[model samples]
Target: MKTRSCFILMGRAVLALALSFCPLITVQAVAAETASASALENSVVKVFSTLRGPDPYKPWSKAGPQEVTGSGVVIDGHRILTNAHVVGYASQVQIQANGAGDKIPATVLAISRGMDLALLKIDDDSFFDSHKPVPRANVLPDVRDAVLAYGYPTGGTSLSITKGIVSRIEFVRYNYPVSGLRIQIDAAINPGNSGGPVIAGDKMIGLAFAGALNMQNIGYIIPNEEIDLFLRDEASGTPHGKPAMFDTIQTLENPALRTFLKLGKNVEGAVVLAPFSKEADYPLKELDVITHIGDFPIDNQGMVKLNANSRVRFQYRVQQLAKNGLLPLTVVRNGASMKVSLPVSSSHPMLIPSLAGNYPSYFIFGPMVFSRATSEFMNVPNGNPQILYGMAFAGNPLMTRRGDKPDAQREELVVIASPFFPHKLMNGYSTRFFSVLYSVNGVPVRSLAHLVTLLRDQTDDLLTFRFEQRDAEAIVVPRKEMLAATESILTDNGIRSEASPDMLKIWNEKTPAGK
Candidate 1:
């Protein structure tokens, strides 16, 4: 009788407490929500970008304008952190504070194309004092922990905030040929939500970047660690973030390749099908089997299981090793384990000397095109044989072929096409042999930088091209002659007008101000 009475009394006490503070709990919740709303409005900034599109086939036509919208967080008084792709190839860029209508023009400060991170600075001085800078958190949270993403999503935005949990800490690839430490979140990251803050409590943990195209609620962010590295590299005046390539042995899937190398099932190693660059030749070989990179052993599946329970595949091993250019690796050949050093140099040799802001020379005097043969276009057979010269290294050429066994004894010439050519011309050309070019008219070619410089200096009545080719005489083609022929052919085929943009700069800078 006493125990039963005690239980009844305890239950009645709980009911009395719940009834007494129900209204008070509701009031506190409302107050807290109001405070959060005010903070979000003050923290988020709206990004405005001017995008451009051209006729894919025309080279002399102008481009049309488009608008891109996104969100950003001010991490420092002068600098804003965001994704590189958000503002890439943009013609104009500006930012708007929450509740403000005026757009403040912004200039890109620096960009890490390999990592997809960009730093921008708004020209307005008032922005520094108006927006409070959010502090970056050094320590990340554990899985299943709550986090908030603040951005101007597709929905009505005073600064839309979404809540989700940490899903994974993975070493996954974001874009092809670029991979690194990635934070996978269960947050809904959509079109306009990119470049926003992924915050925990009051601190920022990462920048929202990419998402799984086929999956729902699966998005990826570049961790604060990478952000910190970017800032550090900026301070030290070093190129941003980890290396882009690595030098390691590849484990081929072909059974005949394994048999040719005299390897058995008991062998635990990978074959070196190709080297990253010429520098890698000092330490790597065509048939060498790689056993390790640093202290991590590579399995037959080409997976390198790190000591920390995380795993990274060897597919991008060349890029990672190229981060420093002087990376060390361990390999096993014929049951012998040995250490080797590899050099991370430019894969394309002839283009390296000319890549530093110089344009190839070309002259348009009569009716012919003049340009030089580059290593870029000549390495392939039957692709762009018009301008190929030399056959010195006849076996395995570097970068001519994307993959396969090394042939160190092969050589080929490079070629280039005019920017104003018909887009249909590229349809049948499946290989890169026709792509290597330096100049159009008396202009020195480096990268595409020559194109912008040449276009701006276009004052000549005729454009002449001088190209290098093996066996065939170096020929000069005139611009007007080609144009007349092109016009006549197009008119006959009932086609008119071209889509190529003549005024646009083709350099890969994210913002127009970058040039």
Candidate 2:
């Protein structure tokens, strides 16, 4: 009987091996887990948007209608929260509840593109009766915490769920509307997962918005803090936007640099490189060392303590302030400590306007097309180096200002958008594309409208166009001949108007009567 006891142990081991090889058992386990996750489907919805935006190159026309899909979650007040990019420039928006067939019409109530969040209201209140709003978490989640992403990701119709963990939480650049703070996770956030909720233990910790293309399983979330700021702004009835820190700053990490600034032993701060705009005139100057913002003391890395254990970039404090509010600062200047207040607002009098969504304003005079130089234009392939340099260094006082010469007073860069089309009036000149216009008839071209005004008032037979270059190329044309060919050029190019609608209005308001 003792020798036969080995048979019982072998039999038990054989039974365990049989269970491990059973596919049916594993299938049942996965099915059970999926059933448990289905409860979250009610709070998520699929968003469909139809967008039509203006064409940047063709200012007078609009781009074709486009259909896009995203995800949204029900929030308080019978409103839905989604990414701003999903509904931006949208002509119509429709929301479909998970596992439902009807698509309810919705409208954007408020949108903050800078934060990449938008709120929508359904046309029918009954839509909310069946779905429950997801609860938002009060604080950020810790690293390695398990999270579930619920959305209608691409490649399927029904709601999808993917399990992941909190990978990182820090200040990361957001792609849309430029960069800002963002959260990262090691989840499969795909094309249609945008605006979906990242749930941790039945509470929403983050909103899935973007993902890294180069790396696998890396996604970004618009954290709850930014969402709260947007909601607060909406409730205040006077939302301006996130406050901007216009002062360019660098860390005083080098010991020699710190010693030169008289930052004795433990003093840590960031050195001001330059203030970008005049509106930032809290009298901030170059070489000023910023040691404190509000009550937060900044370290040499340009970071401030968010908590006893966590620290964030110094700009986070500025972003927390209300727009147009005053921000207090402690700075070391000329080896002396001083306190100052800086206005909290975005840059104004911008020399380079963003052309991401808006159309570029343009005016056509005969064969030459005049348009304002913008960041979009500067990015054109194989663009003029001089024009790009001029546009880039236009406002930097350190680079543009020389000896008693005041900062370049030109407010906008007006450029010839196209190479000279063959015409008798434009002959005898090599018309380079993107040549910045310096002056018209001895008058400095301040802006596009100013150039138009200068041209409108010109009584001389020969109209001279001076360009901003080392050679200072000049283009001379007969005024009467240039005026006579405008209509023909418009007709040949299939352009409906001589100038953009805004430019036409400007010309009408500024041009003299009966000229």
Candidate 3:
């Protein structure tokens, strides 16, 4: 304790000596920083949203209304910019200024769930009269630059400003299947800190969007580059998402890998384990190493130099350099070096897809309820890893077919969304909830719509359902009797809709000649 106190005293003495030598310069710098921070506080806002998130467990209806709070900041063009997650699926949204007593209602003018960005328009333009947009820095800030994170984070009613510095920056994943430039800071970004502004000097550098989970004194911000792209894309009426490559990749840092690829010693870039598309004419394929994105050379770690000290993943350059969804790349294939115009896309089809704040499509039969398998639904077993292991042991498609892309015949895996509804028809049946439907009767279940159609057009005496499991029993139901009792079951269960709108349309579609 004495040693630490002595060090602290020595530091204070050194500071006092420096202050005495240049008191005016020191005071002026401090005053300038303080004024800058104070000006930015007025622009920050508290965002309140009433969101109706999808209920994957009960696909028939949405979950209860949830009131969530986050932060936002006024940007250029009389718009309020915030994180997409802050207001995604929001039914109602309102914003309150730093010390304002009344809330101003706002509507989402544009939103990008992939990039986690949204632009809001307020009903009252007079709100901007008192709150002016803070000047934003055009360029990225350097590491170690002092920053002030302003927001109404949880545990406070008013705006909270936390002092920190730029820790690091990288091109990393934001939401699933989306990647962008993210800046990490040493500030304490709490729950409500999301969508707030991170100020440096006299301008705003980024918005605090997320915090590092399970870590202390670490938070992440969305830099101006991403926000600018979102703003420009939103202006086009139809939002064209940020382009990215979802191809399977791996770093080429191993000596054996280089020797196998016949790569030269000086060669540096990430090697492609598998290309995104399997088409014959696709530009990329297995063993093709990506050497450069546009003109920026990539390192073995799949990183491109952003500046003198900052390096981000080569994929980040795809968003900036891509033209008409074509990203220029330098590739080395079979010891031949050449340039390729890689066709990148903003979306990827997966067997189990992310819900993206949308409700899952569902179709409920006599007793069994089925819905499209989604990433959120699959994660329901997270509370018990043992259940996941059990599913894996039982050959659950949810565990096996994850990360797989859709094919011609099978586009999605349909799962038993919920346990059997209360009905005498469901009596004596074992629980088959969460099982992937393999087939119905004698036909393969291609999708939820297909399953509904098969059930609707059934003529057999018995309806047999097979699941994708090793130890599962075939569930047989009295076909005509089950269909007859569906209405009564719905009444007993109080289920208003027989199926989701899309599935209902397929159910009501005309049957073909031979069934």
Candidate 4:
């Protein structure tokens, strides 16, 4: 009986030892998985960009280089995901792997300015083999959920991952202050962290884009949906379509127009300052009041009030378009409400480009350069006297989020300028498009091509250019020396590229080959 009892005790002890060892083996497996992930992080890299100047013209200048730093995640063997603004205008770009020597050369694959997302491609892919592209989780994490932001920040060189929570997911512009989109997270993001990945539970929820300068611990991201859209656009060759533009708009400042709409008590509408080319097609007049956009009501200040109790007014119709691009509008004319289809155009009325394309074609005579009127170059103020009298129309909207004020003094629309103009018209030609130039001897000044053609054809000691400006001014430029004088003036003003119609012309082409 004693031998049997001893055998039972020995068997029970062996069973207990086996159970304990099983748990130890499981813990070791989990630790190994975590270590593997840490090793995969080496695939991520840091991107640095250096710009020569504010303009693209002097991109290779030796002046102090303006540097921008951002984070990038390896999406594939050779591709990285980042923010467009981080390297969009960069003249030179360098990418550094965690343990690599000199940075690698990188090129932009695609960019979505509205969404603030960009894709980059590198030459080699050997650095990432066992890596996996972070999966896009369908469900959005609620506010206050645990979140992680991975990137290379200011202090350290290698990958830095910070932990935080989702404070909110509101429709806010991720980069541009005037625009807004859906973003998540309460992570504290800084300058160098712009293009990093915002992860939740080992899944990519969004891409870090911007942070509020006035607020602490506040950052924004581009959600995974935007990333999907960008990838699809890359396959399609073109991204999302650009917003449609209208030509005329008006300020809501006049008391008569405001009182007619009963705006002071309960204001609602955008005022029709003047029409672009299409204004003649609508019943809108200079003083016509625009009360509602689609269903969004306007306030007395000519602003579309969104969440009025919150006191937020939007300047561009683009914001409304971004909210919902297709919507009807209600306009008030002579104290009567009339519904009209709202055309999408520039917020300023006078600058609407009657010319085709975003950039205008230019004609150059020796040094004298001329371009047609476009929405961007026009800076006319709202409610011009000519508009009120029904003799004039604006090419842009009346209100905008641009730096120029609605009350800015407008110059006349000049299309022609020449030294042979009557001295009286020449005095004010600089102020209007009436002084813009078209051609030198019918060379068809359609682009930089026309300019180059004319320069090569120059043999006459005295050259003449036919000029056309608004307000019925036609001028002829004579004497080749006068044209040379104009070139000197342009160079002194730091205007290097005469091809672009906009003042911010950076890209230039001296010949067709250069283009």
lDDT (CA) per prediction? 0.59, 0.77, 0.88, 0.57
- Candidate 4 displacement at residue 10 in angstroms: 13
Per-residue C-alpha lDDT of model 1 across residues 358-422, encoded as one tens digit per residue? 22333211121223333222334335443322322322122344332223222222233333334
Expressed as tens digits, the lDDT of each residue in 1-515 for candidate 4 is 89998999888889888887998998998888787557546656799987543211121122356788898877743578898777865678778876677788888887765567788887676645644465666665666778888787888787887788877655544332223445656678887888888888767788887778888888877767557656765778754433333434656767775666565545455666665343366545666677776667777665653332232333334434533344366777666777776544223333323222122454433334444344333333233555323223322222222233222222222232223222332444343232333455654354334444565445655444443322433334444455445455556646565444432232232322211
Question: Which 10 residues in a row give candidate 4 its minimum summed lDDT?
Answer: 53-62
Write candidate 2's Cα lDDT for 115-204 as tens digits: 789999987887778787888998978778898888988888899888899876776445322345577788789988999999888789
> Which residue ranges in model 2 land beyond 4 Å of their true spot?
1-39, 175-179, 275-283, 321-324, 382-408, 418-424, 427-431, 470-473, 510-515
Candidate 2 TM-score versus the reference: 0.81
* Cα-based TM-score, every candidate: 0.61, 0.81, 0.91, 0.56
* Number of clashes recorded per candidate: 56, 0, 0, 46
Which prediction has the highest lDDT against the true structure?
3
Q: Give the winner by lDDT: 2 or 4.
A: 2
Better candidate by lDDT, 2 or 3: 3
Clashes of 4: 46
Instruction: Name the regions of candidate 1 deviating beyond 4 angstroms.
Output: 1-41, 52-62, 139-145, 172-176, 238-241, 246-271, 278-281, 297-300, 304-309, 314-324, 345-515
Question: Worst 10-residue stretch by lDDT in candidate 2?
Answer: 397-406
Evaluate model 2: give its lDDT: 0.77
- With a 3 Å backbone cut-off (N, CA, C), the pairs that clash in candidate 2 are none
Which window of 10 residues has the lowest lDDT sum in candidate 1?
350-359
